[model samples]
Target: MTNNNNISLLTAILFFSILIPLFLSSPPSSSTVSTKTLVLPLKIQKPPIGFLSTSKASNSSNNKLSFRHNVTLTVSLTVGSPPQSVTMVLDTGSELSWLHCKKSPTLNSIYTPLSSSSYTSIPCSSPVCRTRTRDLPIPASCDSRKLCHVSVSYADASSLVGNLAYETFRIGSLTRPGTIFGCMDSGFSSNSDEDAKTTGLIGMNRGSLSFVTQMGFSKFSYCISGQDSSGVLLFGDEKFSWLGPLNYTPFVKISRPLPYFDRVAYSVQLEGIKVAGKLLPIPRSSFVPDHTGAGQTMVDSGTQFTFLLGPVYSALKTEFVRQTRGLATVFEDANFVFQGAMDLCYRVPPNRKGFSDFPAVSLVFTGAEMSVSGDRLLYRVQGMTGKGGDWVYCFTFGNSDLLGIEAFVIGHHHQQNVWMEFDLAKSRVGFAEVRCDLVSQRLGALGLNT
Candidate 1:
């Protein structure tokens, strides 16, 4: 028994002795950094309830869940020393990357730092720990072990708590070493079933701690496909071969210090909104931010539905309802809001095939206009009076006041079939209409299938 114990101790020592060199060795230069462009494939995964028209990654699989009114856009990446695969939601509204630790409740696969030779915990005294929460409202705390810990809480009340650490992240052929992320041991979600499928989230915002900013990438682009197809994600400045004509809009910077407003999010200017080729009566000031930086418009892929500021949304909805009064019966039940947010529902007659006659809604921005037409304007919500094959279609736009947020958010639902380029170098965003599935195929052909 003593001989066996000696042998076990020696084996443990030998394992570390062999791996010590690897831990000290510098990582390979990231392909995302060296290459002019890095492309990663993305796919759309349906939720449990199937299709509710909720506005919404990755190799061959990326799932976005609309459960509990939270829409998440996910991507697949490998992490750690030997590299374990992890599913992370791509959130432009947030500024931090994180992963679920082994102690999480769900039986899904999680990151086990102890098994990773390259995982390095940030000490409480480290500068990285001190400024980790610079862009976030939450502050970093130190545990009894003197390890830097962070707690992240989203707008939906989903929270994650864990130690701050550095690990290697590999996306497609690119590898980013010593990337800082939260190794969350505890997580709380509004819906466990849907959240269980994903390990954590990857923040792609403009903050200092964001993945794109940390990796030193000046530009990134993504094409979000429709419900039935895949898409593509690209990092760096090199343009893709298939990219078409794109309209550009400069990013607006809010220098005003506002405690409640989100400064890290991508903000864009809104000139006006048009419905059925007619402009609404809302004043231009309604779209502008106040002294506190409230009422800014952001393009966030994390949110499933588009949310306009209270007055702006009201004006748009009023104009929209007036335009389509006789086409379909208005669903006027105030208590029957679909998913507790979308209230402008209409019951279409079974004889009518689809809402083809619905007027197109266009969001006019500075130097750019996004047109939402046909099925994209209205979502066919499931389980809404199925008698006689009559379908219920609800307007995709919602009020941001319902979420207690003062800003206008352009969600994932409206980004489908659009090539969106977030250019950091020029401080501008570019958008163009194209088939995202074709983009996905092109990326897959480039050997980014996994």
Candidate 2:
């Protein structure tokens, strides 16, 4: 009896040790397991995830979500003796238009500054100028100083700083009176060299002091093409069928600056998936914001991928790994194990699903839910070594190891013609779709391979 009691005690200790942690970490579920417990790990460390305290602002009056697709625009820079054509990222999150300066002595190689004479400046005393400066955070020098000073700080610690100047800028066939742009004099050396390609960014998103907003077009809409084409940003009430039914979410005031050109928050509903006409449980989160350090949905067109936070990232990765247990081979690249390519000839285990048969991963935005159409879910990056050994894969979700922020990022190239509308009065956001083919042609003409 004594021996049996001792044995029983030891067994109980071991059982509880393993079981307690599993129960603590498991995600919320209706069913309970007798002996098994789920263990989910938290990702971010410093600032805890979730809502922070903030002051309440009046919700904007326009609360509907909608979009315009494939609207084209002509962007030019008047720096040299003759003007030059340049592509621009129309972003509402941002407040200024900037160009990559090739000849400005003070300009960084990553950013090209337009000539001083290329734009007209609003004096400090002007009423509109004061309002623009006050609302947009433009410097005091912009008041009386003909040249407007502007700066953009990115989540990756990269920044573009320059003087704000107004120049003749056109989008599609509609030419605005004059547009204010930032003549970039400095490059964000912290970012990769690829960030330097564009002439400048066009801030068209909500709350930004761009030409469109300053000119009083509060209800502007635009489109961006997909990876195959140059995207379009339009300002006006034009509508499109591709925008689908409008869903609007109130814009939550951000405690910190957002990853996009401006601070805008969105609420998305991910109706579970439909497999073979049957619905499967789909994950949903309300506060997922754009990943910082990555480019904005409106600007930084060079990035080819998007990122998500740790919880979502881990969930997706675990599911994919479990589904492709047999076909998945771990390849070491840059300190991470990537799922490598495999042939489908080998038979998969009865319990394990093959990679080839994995269901498509869909991302639902306000306007549409896009599915991954390719065989491979990860986009493999060429290894730094010439031997093609240490390749890196694009992360679909998680904090960017490079950016160090807890957010989701949508690359501009992948989400062209997707319109983001911000209504300050209504405190709501909207989305729409656009055509990407013509945008692609324009990008090709400018040596940009989408």
Candidate 3:
């Protein structure tokens, strides 16, 4: 839907509904298996233009879409009997799909169980409640009604208290009955502005109860376009020549339980970092997770900026400052930090229209590399300017230490314009840089025929 100013976002949920039935209805021999693509068009809203105000900036880093708020990758899902379409965030960092069940004055939509003919809450005696949720950060418990219930809290301080239930889910032509999900009865969000507009979240993490795992999909891919446009989310192993040959990296295999890291996270081995074509002096061992499992690098679509450990961040910031000494004047004011985390601020000259003089930054993984240059290297923190009315641009990377999270994170800002394929069967992640707008256009034109 477009705003009154003519800025458009995704208006519909496009799907190739034939996929689920083809894979689930019958057992296919190796020779008979179909590798057809299942598509879901993704919607993302752009941050407003310069000099905008947001009340939810400090709630969490995920809310900070590179200093812009309310940016999320969303898709529509039809849930309950006599299904109703609900907008959901497609999150790779969370495990359970949930819908807001309680009606609130501020909420746009809620799934009322009394209205659904097929809604059935799981009893506390059910093993599905106990076994399936054992590994989750927030495990299931029995409510006063002897129903399976859970209370989940996000880093943003938003929470959902819900009961586990089984209900029918409709995805285009494919209707799956008795699907398990969370029917939340109560919740509170620090960012009620965006929460009021959407229903809930769809978890796509590596955990057992995630949407991809529940659907039995061996692989999935998504292309996040520039903020103004729509993108495509795909499931199954259909390869496109236009995607080109992707660089592959193996996900870290944890043999035992981790002390600090989320065991089910999509983590990869990070080799090193390079600034201005020169590799940093940090040691490779520093990137490896210690006995406490603290340093593994994870790819999280929910977060907005990349975060590194304190030592690694110091090395990077030092090298970056060294290379861009004369390009722009550093904002040396003690209070220049943004959100109390991003401290590398610079005052660009009034005539400086671009950041071409700044050095490029690269994150080198085992068999892949993510390079950031031009506008990607620095984000303009609008609504706030430096002395002499010069615009301020801060480095996009942040310190993971600020969050007390010991692991490194690669967030959404770096994933733009790239096709990321998470192959669960092979336990590998494939990435290739491409114009996501082209993929969105091609998929939009093909529609559900594919």
Candidate 4:
């Protein structure tokens, strides 16, 4: 993630805001009209009392840990009358999938289709259309059927606006029956030259009206293999038992839901730590429940590092330096480190104490607990920035970013099973197992250096 790459990623996001309007004027072919109605198997449920609260559980014995792996689905969006496939980042943090459209007012570097037959736009009045034209700057005369409008905000102070449409969207072996996404008419120009390569983005978070949800499919999962194998998003019953064991966590709804979807919330416990094979002074009281937006854990396969908030970030870095001082060397990279220059390498001395002192990071959930090996937690990704000379383990977006809702982001790539089960009626979240190897393999193939 060089400065050039970061700018490119940002540019791609900004471009969608401008290019969504051009394709709205065209009508869909009669053959493209979908006659099939989609019905999902999983039912949306409510949460139980104190489901997302930080208070102690009444039945502490009921707390259990489950495991599951995070999955990635590649989304391709084609723009214009003759649609063309565009490569984009499928992000759960985002809410819509949009491409560069023909009517874009501003242009830089992007793919536009030469033929009009490839893409289709859903009318504004369509029952599924969740956006309003007034929200966007679109003129009232712009036939809603021709243009699709949508709004999306990110933790990093970035926002997107574009038109929505139904186009051919493919993920692994599954092709959505009739996919609805966004197409940016313009806005994605970049100050840096590298920003132009991206085509669009795909949103895969819970509570999103993504292609998976729009097609009326429930219980969608995928595996993000490490940098070697292309990640796959499983749809319907396309099962893969090799995904290790499946684990589930409850999806906490936001007190105030966003325009297009609900927010996912959860509690995390800092528990304790093991340094040099000895119990450290870390306190259980140090484990406070984070309900602010800044505490959002990005379950993103697209991201390599597991970013933590300010307090956790500081404590982890300090302990790593204290315990591994002999083998570690401070670098100008603004983060603590062992002795390696590249690939987040940390040198471990050949001694019993060295091995015993290895850092063990744990995450305590309501009824379950998970740990990150010292090596993995200390692993670093290229081009990540840190604050006050610390490695970029996680970032703090502050409470404003969350808009008073909590964000537990699962990176598009990571080696863990992340299950999100929402029981609306009981308001209680469940825990599942997370498989690491599967997540590593999936993310590795996508060029993410996790």
Best by lDDT: 3
> What would you estimate as the lDDT of candidate 2?
0.35
lDDT, candidate 4, 44-145, per-residue tens? 111122222232211133321111111223444444434455656545444355655554334343555335454555665654443333222233223434
Candidates' C-alpha lDDT: 0.67, 0.35, 0.68, 0.37
Which regions of candidate 4 deviate over 4 angstroms?
1-83, 102-114, 122-161, 172-178, 188-195, 227-229, 238-244, 254-298, 332-357, 379-450
- Give lDDT: candidate 2, residue 90: 38
Deviation of model 2 at 406, angstroms: 4.3
How well does candidate 4 match the true structure, expressed as C-alpha RMSD? 13.5
Q: Give the poorly placed runs of model 3, Cα more than 4 Å off.
A: 1-35, 50-69, 349-352, 445-449
The alpha-carbon deviation from the true structure for residue 224 of candidate 3, after best TM-score superposition, in angstroms, is 1.1
Worst 10 residues of 3 by lDDT: 14-23
lDDT (C-alpha) at residue 47 in model 2: 15
User: In model 2, which runs have C-alpha deviations exceeding 4 angstroms?
Assistant: 1-84, 90-92, 101-118, 122-147, 187-196, 211-304, 337-358, 364-370, 373-376, 383-392, 400-402, 413-450
- Writing each residue's lDDT as its tens digit, candidate 1 over 1-450 gives 000110110000000000000011222333344545777766554464543333321111222222253345668889988999988877676666788887556648688898898788887777776644444445676899998877765444456678877788888777778777778888667666666777877778777667887677888888888755467788877656678789998888867656545655677898899999999988999988777667777787666678787788889889999999888887655655554446688877657766678899999999999988877887766544433556667788876665456677777778899999999889888999888877777677243522
Q: Scored by Cα lDDT, where does model 3 land? A: 0.68
Is 1 or 2 the stronger prediction by TM-score?
Answer: 1
Clash pairs for candidate 3: none
Candidate order (lDDT): 3, 1, 4, 2
